[model samples]
Target: MKRNKYLILILLTWSLFPFCWQVYTSFSVSESILNPISQIESRWTLDNYIQVLTANPPFWRYLLNSTIVGTLSTVLTILLAIPASYAIARLKSFSKNTIKILLLTASLFPYVLLFLSLLEIARKLDLGNNLVALSIPYAALSMPLAILLLSSAFQDLPLNLEEAAIIEGLDLWQRIRLILIPLISPTLASTGIIIFLFSWNEYPIALTWISKSELITLPVAIARIAGSSVYSVPYGAYAAATVLGALPLILIVLLFQRQIISGLTQGAIKG
Candidate 1:
């Protein structure tokens, strides 16, 4: 019992530590974040958030950009992946296995290697300073996993239903629209939420490519809290922004928890 209690305490601390620090820091003034020995409770103020949120470019704009990018990326990813996943699942085509392998292999490959290439492409396309650049990378990054997940859901569905529909002279589109989409919706939703989180939290790419301050995402805006210059960063506002940034994800997970749980648990094992 003692061991279990200790382990639980350790896990809770590990999980909550960052949030705790963020909350403590967010309430801290700009001076405290810069000072190593600053007392946590002594430096509380609303100025950091005020400064961070109302700076020349503003944090609210960045939050909006993040929302747009995350939402659009998730929507587009689902739209594209759903049809492709359905095709791969149902069509026993010659190239189906190869496509799946390629998707898996690409997903396994680290995104680090392609950063330079993506950067170059972004510059050429004039997408470097815009949210569009991040959206493409986010979609590309998520596609492989989406395919794999959606494939499982599709496979879990009994083939007889498909065969029956075909026998009744239902065309491919009809079969997909009528039969597959409805059955595998939970898994599809899971893929969408996962992709949205990836897009929402992506920081490194945003840092490198986003030069216009107006195009800042939440992560980059929060980074500014630590100060790029020798100037002090406001910790409290950064904490608030962090909380604000996290709220959507929390809601999404909570809202979909049941479906995600049921779908993943009952998902198809065999193709």
Candidate 2:
């Protein structure tokens, strides 16, 4: 146990080294992009965070756009996924392989292949480079994972509880609403946090769909910092923005850590 503990500590040190360096670099203001050597060679200042927070392009707008898109996308995806998962787990009206195939189809379908089609759909729908377009693709992309998770949650739930509810004269909706949903709520929380983090960190769809500067997500804003000058990028601002963008996910992970780990572990064990 002692040896295993030491090994885990060593692994954790290696894992956290880069993030520690980033936190260090984020406080450095030297013109040399705030690297390890720069940390050793120069003095620390708060200017980088200040510049990142107050720069003309304004990082806050990116935060807002990302938050809006991430939130809307996660919520809509979870809502859509819940019913689909319920049907798959409870009804089984369709073949299980067919359900799996549809999920795989949703996930494996190349987004790039359908880019222009999605663009036209976005334009026709008048969603137009904001949360709507970002959310649609994000919802589509995240649906598979959500279904897989909630379906597992639904299946893990003891059928006895469901049957008892039904025996009490509760119909399908009441059984699901009063029994299944409550039982699976922890799993739902886990899935929501997972989906939120995925949506929050999504990059490709954001780049493809969003055009206007004000509408661009934090990832795009951070990319703009990479092009701060015609040929040069401020790695300092890039690193800082990365840390900022990750802050939300960090808080969310911490909040959901227990339930997320429990649900995933239980699901894996069951599967």
Best by lDDT: 1
lDDT of 1 by residue, 57-135 (tens): 7667877898888988898888888777877877665577777788889878888888888888888888877787678
Model 2, range 1-271, lDDT digits (tens) per residue? 9999999999999999988778766776655452445535556677767778886668888888888988898889988988889888876646755786788787767767777887787778877776866788878878897897788678768889877887799998788788888778778988787777777777766786788888888877787773487666666666788888888888888887887677667768777
What does the lDDT come to for candidate 2? 0.78
**lDDT of model 2 at position 31:** 54
Off by over 4 Å in 2: 31-35, 38-41, 91-94, 108-110, 226-231, 264-271
Each prediction's TM-score against the native?
0.80, 0.86
Where in model 1 is the C-alpha error above 4 Å? 1-13, 28-43, 91-99, 167-169, 226-233, 265-271
lDDT of all predictions: 0.79, 0.78
